[model samples]
Target: MRNRLVFSAFSAAAVLAVVWPFLFGGQLAWRDMLVLDYPQMTASNFGGGDLFARNAPQDGFLSIIAVVMPATWVVKALMVASAVGAATGAWWLSNKELLPTLSAIALAVANPFVIERLLQGHWSVVIAAWLLPLIAAAALNGRALLVWLLVFVASLTPTGALVGITVALVCMNKHRLVTLGLGVLYLLPWAIPGIIATFRGGQDMNPLAAAQAFAPRAEEAVGTLGALLGLGGIWNADAVPDSRHLGFALFGLGVFACVLLGIRSVPKRLIVLALVGMGIAIFAWLAPAAMAWALEHIPGAGLFRDSQKLLILALPAYVAAI
Candidate 1:
């Protein structure tokens, strides 16, 4: 019960500290999260005729939910809920030790990654953050069915679904094949259709050229490595929170360095996935040509032009590693 209270307090504080504006000011649409303009369900909400269907599942879910409440309220409420849900997911993964729990929660909700994603209006990514930890706990605890269900729902976002699929592969010891099938099942609704449409239409893009445009950015005074370690290099200057520049990013670097001490606590497969995730983020900067080639050749690889989302795959490992 005490741990529950701690979790609840931190979850609420995490949301209120950064997202009070969304809560008090009501719905504010920015970037990809412009659901306020069309709050109600329509025939078009479920249809993304073009490839990528980037808004799949989330936008459609919003349409159904908005019918229950005003769109403004629904938008703000979901934002608040996703933020709180992130912290709660961290707490769920913790071992009930106060310090470790606090550290895990901070990594989960208050990190620069969550803030940057939120500012960029990528609430679905934030929802994925929440789902990642929940799925991790289920996988770690040997709850196969729960892991499959959570991973299936993570298909709401393509990037999140990618990370979620990785979670099933790296974290589970049993039902690996069956769990992996759930990953494919989730993709069936959106990914397959989008890929087919892209090929059928021959909508070609120069992935090599586009890679530079979507590469991870250097942060203010901290540089690209620091920003990526600090979880702040989000490719859009406007998306980074102001606090990141005010010494918080440097602090995050130090904390992330210290987080490596508990590396043995996490499963080895999870560690490999985390390293691969960070490596992928850096690859765009170090080997843009190779990254672009993969983007050009790999089906749906174009979606990762903003490769930082790949770090979502590492969230579970980071929390456990710490």
Candidate 2:
């Protein structure tokens, strides 16, 4: 109970730390502010139809949700409930370690830069963040059908694809066929339409080119020093995003400490996954040169253009490793 209280308090504090600044419509740093935008300008119509030119799934799942029950209070209640689902999922997956569990709770609460983005209107990302751990728990428990149902529901939203794919890969089940079939089932609705539209030249983008885009080259890779501090350091710092990178480092350190102390032995496979994921995050956050090299040599380096996605991969990597 004491631990739970600590968890709740930290979760609420971290969330408020990220969220309170914007509650009054006050300006956020560029990246936090950008969350207000991003997916809208992405390569696909998966964000939405070509309906408004703003036609992207920025709020895909949320829009459908609002339509079903348009009241603000109702939506907030439902979203909060979903956030609880996400927290529960994290708890189940974390091997019952106090610090790791606390970290996961903190991540879930402040995640995707807190529920602020959702409150501000980017419901798709919020939904995806909320679903991420839940789906991972289902996969870890070998509940293929449950995972499938989640994927299907999440697929109706925008960022869900990313979260679903991350969980699938990290869980790395031997029953790949089950996960694949379920994924295809969930995605087929959007996939079929997207493909048809492409063939008819009505699709939203050039998939080939879209797949090739890299991280914005000009954005400097900030290090962990400023991250240790609450604000971004002097050099071209993007505060929240930079601070998040710090959070990732702390997460990595926590795992390393666990491993070093022989708290328990971890399997080799999970260790490999965690190390690789952490390496990727470090490369992206500390070495601009390495990040560039990756962008050139690796196809999906750009997919995680926003280093924030590293947490998506990192959390499961840690959970599995633990």
Candidate 3:
């Protein structure tokens, strides 16, 4: 009962964190939500359009829901659900005593990566991020089939798919070949479109220039560094709320102290995840030259135009590791 209460509190907090900013006017006038997609989605032949033809299947699925329900309600529900789901998933994955689980849940659901994504109105990525912990839990339990299905759902977004693959690779220690095969099979729907798009070659930008453009700013480097410790980092100045820098600093300090006190208890994989996430972020932000070289020479490195998306994977890993 106590555990349940703790989980409930964390879930409520998570939902509120995401929804609080929009509660004032109860408006659904945000970025993609206010676009023509809402009307297009409400139409019976929503998915038949070219806009959705190349889009992730998840978009179509959401459109179907919108067709029957109020669009505003659907969008609001999903936003809240994403936060609660993330908190719940993190709580389950922690598998620790109350204090650690609570800490992990707080860090996981309230971080900068999530806040930034929410602000950007990337619902698919948000949903995928929320599902990651559940998928990881399934993988750790050797529920190979369940993990594959969850990964398939997550793969509807490219970033989510990448994180799914990482989690599967990390957790599916047994029957590795079978897990790999399942992953390939489930990812085909999303992968096929991306593959075709890549070959079709749209507007090509200088890889280094793209990286430098999207990389975290130097002034916000502290937040990005704090993100390595499970705080938030939002690169866009307009998107950041007041006092966020101070919040990031406090969160980072708290996490640092926790790590120092519980270093031995931390999972090795989490340390590895932090290093990998930080390395990718730093390379894109500070070493754009090398990233550009990779983009120029490597066939698919350009997929990571916004290399900061790698932090999505790191956030969940940070929670589970805690």
Candidate 4:
């Protein structure tokens, strides 16, 4: 009962965090929160367009459901359900350490970019973001069932879910392979659909074409060092020119802080989580080309476009850090 009450309080806080700004900014909506191009894809998909968000419209799983459901109230109901699930996941994964969990979620919430994502109806990001900690918890405990469940839901969003699940696994100790298997399992269902979507949408990243195009840009200052030092380059919400670019400076700082915290305070087992997270982080930061190479070579890998999504690798690192 105490736990339930505490969970309720924190959930309330999370919802308030998300809603307060909209209210303050005078953008509160009685119908929905599709603030920008969000409603475009939602509206279009409802009208039977599979060409939804070809240029990446925040990966609209929640919105897609809103379109599919018959009842008007179901959309709002599901939105609340997703938000509650995310909050519950956050609470369960916090290790009874309220401050850090609240801080982390709060940081994510207070972030102008994140707020903008909410306003723009990027419910998928918010939904995936809320699930990061729970996924980490599942990974740490070697909860195969939980891990796969997350992976399956995650694959639907492809990019963010992969990012979150990858980060969570990197933070685990006992079930790295198990988590990988789960990720693969979850992604398998979407393989055909994603491939079809890519071709139909013409958004597939042509590695050969990208490499050829790369000849002139001189890499455009995308080094991991520059990214890390720049606070994961998050200050520029438009930093990577797309939502797929998860390399925000705030995320970097969060991971860095996690590393320092692990070194100072966390247990050995938990430190293992941090170490794995840092390993993936360093790999992404240090040898980005190699990272890209691996992603390209790996099946279902092309679904993730930006190297910055590697920031999802830092979620567990934050868990260990805090």
- Residue pairs that clash (backbone atoms under 3 angstroms), model 1: none
lDDT of 1 by residue, 72-144 (tens): 6766665566666567667777777888888887788767777788889887787777678778777777989
Q: Which stretches of candidate 4 lie over 4 Å from their true place?
A: 1-11, 19-90, 93-101, 104-122, 139-148, 160-185, 194-255, 263-301
What lDDT does the true structure give each of the candidates?
0.75, 0.48, 0.63, 0.48
Model 1 poorest 10 in a row by lDDT? 43-52
Compute each candidate's TM-score over C-alphas. Answer: 0.88, 0.57, 0.79, 0.57
lDDT of 3: 0.63
Candidate 1, residue 118: lDDT: 82
Which stretches of model 2 miss by more than 4 angstroms?
A: 1-63, 71-78, 95-100, 111-123, 156-159, 169-175, 189-308, 319-322
**Backbone clash tally for model 3?**
1
- Per-residue lDDT of candidate 3, residues 61-178 (tens digit): 5566666764456555555665666787677677658888888787667666666666766666776777776677677778888777777767756577777877777876676687
Clashing pairs in 3: 112-232
Root-mean-square deviation of candidate 1: 2.7
Model 2: lowest-lDDT 10 consecutive positions: 226-235
Per-residue alpha-carbon lDDT of candidate 2 for residues 1-322, written as tens digits (9 for 90 to 100): 8877876676566555544444443212333223321123233434334432122333343344444443233334444655665666667666667877776665555543333244334444555666666777777667777677666555644246655754665565766777777676665545554445444544243333332232221222424532211111212233234434444435434444543454244444444544554455445555656665554456434445444333444444343333
What value of lDDT does candidate 1 attain over all alpha carbons?
0.75
* TM match of model 2 to true structure: 0.57
